[model samples]
Target: MQPNAESVVVLDFETTGLSPDQGDRAIEIGAVRLQNGVITERFQQLMDPGRRISPFIEEYTGITNAMLADAAPVSQVMAEFADFIGDDNLVAHNASFDKRFLDAEFARISRSYPGEFACSLLVSRRLYQDCPNHKLGTLVRWKNITGEGSFHRALYDAEMTAYLWLAMLADIREQSQLELVPFELVTELSKTAKKSVGAFFSRW
Candidate 1:
């Protein structure tokens, strides 16, 4: 996805477990629609995976099986989420994990989104090396992204991640003295060596 795109869907999924390959599935989906640097809309759903959530999963995400009991089925929820996503690019902390589940879930409903996925975690690792970790919670605390959402919850993490994405873009704009941060700049930044980021962007 073009990092500089005016609109993007920042998404996060709380799954029954890690690795969809091992039969795990998403229990909750949360996302914020960010357009022109503002969150204009939001989408969230608790899904039923046709199974009980593990104790650890329940505790970690605070999404109880009881809460999901009356929720929509996984396939039904996935279909609606696909519609909510429309064609917007996606952003996530560690996007690979989310992307994997997205692909898996969408396939169940014969839906797929072609937008590119960008990893804020990767971008942060390149931009901010002083931080001890690049986790969403770590970035939230390090950058002081103001809010009252707890970690592990999909909506809160997605909201916080959206703020963090904007913060980084703002930093880039002020530092480069550019009208708006270029999407290519962030794409390149994600692939650039940490030590070379400053020099690489300098030439832009």
Candidate 2:
């Protein structure tokens, strides 16, 4: 996949807790579909996890227990989200967390997606080592990415992640003199040593 030339979905999830394997479920899901570097579609949903959210999680995400009282169940929302993601590559800030919830929720619905997942967090650690930190809010401010919503909420975080993804692609294109940034290059950069990163791109 040429990340700069094709459709990609940037996604974020606000969960009832941290670990999906430990019974934490997604309380909210927010995603944006980007095509050719422009956001073309958006998805956001609040789901009831059939369990009560703790005070810590509620305060952290600003999503109250009452807010989820009438929300849809995980199975229904996951089905729709799976459809929204149809065959497009997926990006998330910390993808392992999101991927766990996605896999668990999809398994409950007997659904699956074929797209590869990328972590903007891992990529940012490689691309912007000078930044004080690689947190979503920090990178958003450091990169001057516009954000329309509050932090810890799914939608706004997803928007910021989309902008970060674009900035990294722009950086690579500028540094490598490439017309388009390939998906493989971004993933490779995430794993490549910082000292040899520039040379690795030149070899590409």
Candidate 3:
């Protein structure tokens, strides 16, 4: 697929804990839909996981159990989010974590959700290896990207990743010269690959 600024959905989730397989669930989900490098829309929601919120997680995200008592369940939120993402590629920092949670939620709802995904962490490591750190906070400081909310919140983190992805794209274009490379080759190279357009590029 063409890796243009458009046709991407930057997503993030705040969860009750680390392992969804252990019954951990998403407490919040957020995404920013972009078209041609501009955000066309956004989605953010607090989800009631029908479970208790551990004090550690609550403190970290400032989302107490009380706050989510009236929130919608993951099944409903995930369906809405799936529609928001449509057929576009999904973007996230350490995307597998988010994808796992999303996939598990879909599985619970008896719905299928297998979609293309891009990891900003992987992208950052490939494109900005010279930088000392690729952590979201470090990148924000290094790139001078401003974020409005606290860390650990889904929407804020997704927005931060979106901005970081844009900056990383600029770096990639400058280094690789807009020649399209298959995401698989980039994966194999452990970095973004430089390829002749005629030799690479595939539609997802």
Best prediction by lDDT: 2
Estimate, for each residue in 59-144, the C-alpha lDDT of model 1 and write its tens digit. 89899989999999999989998989997888888999999999999988899997888888999998789999998888888998
Q: Which 10 successive residues of model 1 have the least lDDT summed?
A: 1-10
Best by TM-score: 2
Off by over 4 Å in 2: 1-6
What's model 2's TM-score? 0.96
| Global lDDT of each candidate | 0.88, 0.88, 0.78
Off by over 4 Å in 1: 1-3
- Alpha-carbon RMSD, candidate 1: 1.6
TM-score-wise, the better of 2 and 3 is: 2
| TM-score on alpha carbons, each prediction | 0.95, 0.96, 0.86
What's the distance in Å from true for residue 149, model 1?
1.9
Worst 10 contiguous positions by lDDT, candidate 2: 1-10
lDDT of 3 at 25: 93
